[model samples]
Target: MEETRVLLRNKDVANMVDVAVSMEHGGYVGLRNALLMDGAQVIETLRDSGLRGRGGAGFPTWMKIKFAYDAGGTSKVVVCNADEGEPGTSKDRILLSTDPHSIFEGMAIVGKAIGAGRGFIYLRAEYSYLFPILENALDSARKSGILGKNILGSDFSFDIEMRSGAGAYVCGEETALFESIEGKRGEPRTRPPYPGTYGLFGLPTVLNNVETLANIGPIFANGVDWFRSIGSENSPGTKLFTVTGNVHRRGVFEFPMGTNLKDIIYEVCGGIAGGKELLAVQTGGASGAIIRPSQIDIPLDIDHVASSGGRLGCGTIFVIDDSNCVLDIVKNTLEFFTNESCGKCIPCREGGVQLLKLIKKISEGRGSVIDIDTMMDLSNTMRETALCGLGHSTPVPVLTSIANFRDSYDRHLDKDPCSKCSPERGLK
Candidate 1:
């Protein structure tokens, strides 16, 4: 995996969170340059840069801004999704902890591009430790004339506030995050009136993940060609992967997009812990699929990982070792989704519960082949009928685990439990 440090360029810089230190290291240059150009030019530059949302969806950042720009609403808003809920994903936390000013700058740029005045950073409860740090950053920017009215002596005035989530994983979804920000139950709203057209108190809103927003400042500072030259044409720029679980050197790693998963695990992460043979690897989060060892060489991009039956969701790479049972992993993943389901849609709410039950049954040596078929059918139904991305993605782990490790599932179906079925294996 080739290292191209765009977002993490300042990772090693001391006192990066301080406004003075950040500015000294070429921090607000992007925003200052952006203020000189027309808003449309900023949008065009983002389009040419081939920047996509670092969130699980991987939607083009320019298209999203274009929708909000074309909507042309007066009461527009920008939202920064700091709710880093995806399992094994902590890159956003690192970014917010180290370089929060970059996200604020990005949000300000989005405000300038889309004609918005107010922005909100919907932070997750677990990451509340970063709240003071981010709040101080926002205060510093405001004190330095970069956040309040007439920023940088320009007529564009924008300010940002932080909102902490109530520990709801579903709220990580854009619409649900919006709902939570509105003081409503954290549930996904029906689409059609997407965020661009109608969002954030029924006004046009542009919401982006923390990492997605982090990319904006660099793109404006370095130009499109400089940004695009680092990664593949389809998926440009570096990606931050939170490589955890069973890896010797588990931490956040930044590499050019489309880098091979094998290199990420073996080279960047220093291979599996204790020299254990690599089993299956989960590329995304709990909602992501399990990639078998044979498919480890697939590029870690949105399209390529999807092509291999996984997603580059939040860039979380969970390295599973040979000692872990696939069935147990699936059970724990299902349990997470089951506990986190918002119960807004039947497919996710009921389907998650049923999937957990079936996985538990199989793990306890009480499952039949019929149960496996039923799980497949139920997963398909959930994927097709779920209300939001959360519901739709809930069954990915179950389906992928069964597909890649059918022998594990089949072994669980045996009349006698396998030796690995001990209570310590995480099965009740």
Candidate 2:
């Protein structure tokens, strides 16, 4: 049987290509039937599917659910982390805006599997346009008996509310999100008690990314074998990539996990917005490492990207052309991390600022050999000492930039300026 192709736009053609048709075409009806029969069966199907988390770490989703289920709690909470603060990443917004119903259904299925009473969709404030759509979908699902008391006529009850994040990037982290939802300042907490054990007001909580939860409805509608057959053995199912930067057809695309990076850039996105040659592609957002064109032909799945010293961080692809300055871009990225650093930790709070200064100095032709050494030194310390992912991954782009674009920095040090940053010489 051929694999099913699902996209946000598929909902727009709901008259012809409905979710049922898509799931049936993809061999997912069995899972859906199993879910309707009993929630325990859905858990078994998910365990068989081997679906891991897609947000970043790629932890097993089933295990996360099992942990929450065994937490011995009556008031468990399900949270969908829609706060996508990663720069150059908009795929979550796309999913929320277009295929919200899928997410809603997924949340419902999860609430059933874990015996949860309430669920929350924590979306970023930037996605204000999607607020009405999500609210309307939840309201519609409730009225139609798809949500609210006794979802699908089962004893399981769930009510979903959409919560807007007030522009905090750290809130993307699960523990911080918990604090934010409680009307407290968003800051990551120390963990021995992971969210699965103790979260969301000291209750067992299962928090998943928007894209991760979006896959749930399809998983229930389709069987484990069907989902396993689509992607790689470890990273199964279709993953969404928000293709941006210099790409002609720059937008969100959903493809199987092992799709070629070259195809995503050249074939799917029409090759870098023009006839310009591809220099590097940012596989993730600011925290992602850059892959040179020589590495473009490599598969775009998590394991493959990791093998190539890159990550499928949120699957945000940025195609960089020769006209752009890698140094400037890296500096800007550092500046973002620096400005957005919640200042909760001394390492991230201070290190991000220091790295940005060095990058800016290099980009402005004011850096010396010592500056590069200083940047590397601080990056090493930050990587080791930082308290959160922000500090841990902050230096990824900086280090990758120096590795791939050493010559750019060298040229600036040699008192030669690139066309992009030659403004110090005042050229028109």
lDDT of each: 0.88, 0.77
**Candidate 2 lowest-lDDT run of ten:** 15-24
- Could you say which candidate leads in TM-score? 1
Q: Number of clashing pairs, model 2?
A: 5
Q: Which window of ten consecutive residues has the lowest lDDT sum in model 1?
A: 419-428
**Local accuracy of candidate 1 as per-residue lDDT tens digits, 359-418:** 878888888999999999999999999999988998899889888999889988955655
Clashing pairs in 2: 28-221, 28-222, 246-272, 246-273, 248-273
Runs in model 1 lying further than 4 Å from the true structure:
421-428
| Clash pairs for candidate 1 | none
Candidate 2 C-alpha lDDT tens digits along 1-428: 12235545354444221334333334223324644656566677778887877788777788888888888868898999999998878878877766667677677777778888899999899888778877877776677666688766667788899899979788898888899999999998888798878998888888998888878766666567778888888789888888889988887788888888898877887786667877787887888997677877977788888877788878888888988888767776777787778898899998888887777677677778889889888998999998888888898888877777777778887464456753332111
Cα displacement (Å) at residue 427, model 1: 9.7
